[model samples]
Target: MPHAYQPPQRRSRLTRRGRLLLLFTALLGLGLGATVLLPLLSPGEAPEKPRQLLIPEGWRAAQVYAAIDKE
Candidate 1:
């Protein structure tokens, strides 16, 4: 009697439910990272410093030029 050949069983890398679960998990992680972690990791702007300038009373233009030249 002659025996019939049998084909090998096929295996799936990912099932439909597994694919959906993986996609959902990836989206959830991204959403949490953007909403919760991004702000915590970002740097805030530094506070501005006050500026001051001084001018002498009755100062002549020539005097200012001489003072700047000395510096």
Candidate 2:
């Protein structure tokens, strides 16, 4: 009987742990991307402009505090 020549079989590079790690990394990336993009994509209220206070010159500190409190 003559022996037959057979080619060696190749194995996968990623093991079970590697596959799980890759999946976890992909999921984490997707979660981070969604977190960053969701606020930008959704329709939301525009930010209100800051209110400016016009204080006359020579106003006392107490007057300024009272005006701020009133507003």
Candidate 3:
């Protein structure tokens, strides 16, 4: 009697768990890279402007000093 021939098996395929782990690792790496690079790529914040006080015209020196101190 003649025996049937069997083909050689391949071993490079990943299991379901392995594929999920690989996907999770890739996503984690991408998130980490973005977290590290986003700050460096973004423009700096604008500087704050100095506070200003508008005093009425003809104000006395003492009044002006008081207004400045009050603010």
Candidate 4:
């Protein structure tokens, strides 16, 4: 008698635990890449200082125009 042939069982889809583990691994990889790679890629220029402007609180449009005209 010939032995009966049987098909292999299909693999199951990822479970909740497997999905969470994949997500954690992806985030850890991205974090490591940023920490190790960013400084090496950045140029050595000193960071530009931001310009400061002082606008008085509650100043109306007319007041701003008058101030500009006085200059």
Number of the top candidate by TM-score? 2
lDDT digits (tens) for residues 30-61 of candidate 4: 99999989998988789889865566999998
Pairs clashing within candidate 4: none
Tell me each candidate's RMSD, in Å, in order. 12.2, 5.2, 10.8, 11.6
Number of clashing pairs, model 3? 0
Can you give the TM-score per candidate against the true fold? Answer: 0.39, 0.78, 0.49, 0.49
lDDT of candidate 1 over 1-71, digit per residue (tens): 59888798798689899999999999999998899987788897776786543458889888877776765
Clash tally for model 1: 0
**Candidate 3, 1-71: lDDT as tens digits:** 59888798787899999999999999999999999999989997987889999999999999999999997
Pick the winner on lDDT between candidates 3 and 4: 3
Clashing pairs in 2: none
Candidate 2: TM-score?
0.78
Output the TM-score of candidate 3.
Answer: 0.49
Of 1 and 3, the candidate ranking higher by lDDT: 3
Lowest summed lDDT across 10 adjacent residues in model 2 is found at 3-12
Candidate 2 lDDT, 9-59, residue by residue in tens:
897699899999999999999999999999999999989999989889999
Runs in model 4 deviating more than 4 A are 1-3, 45-71
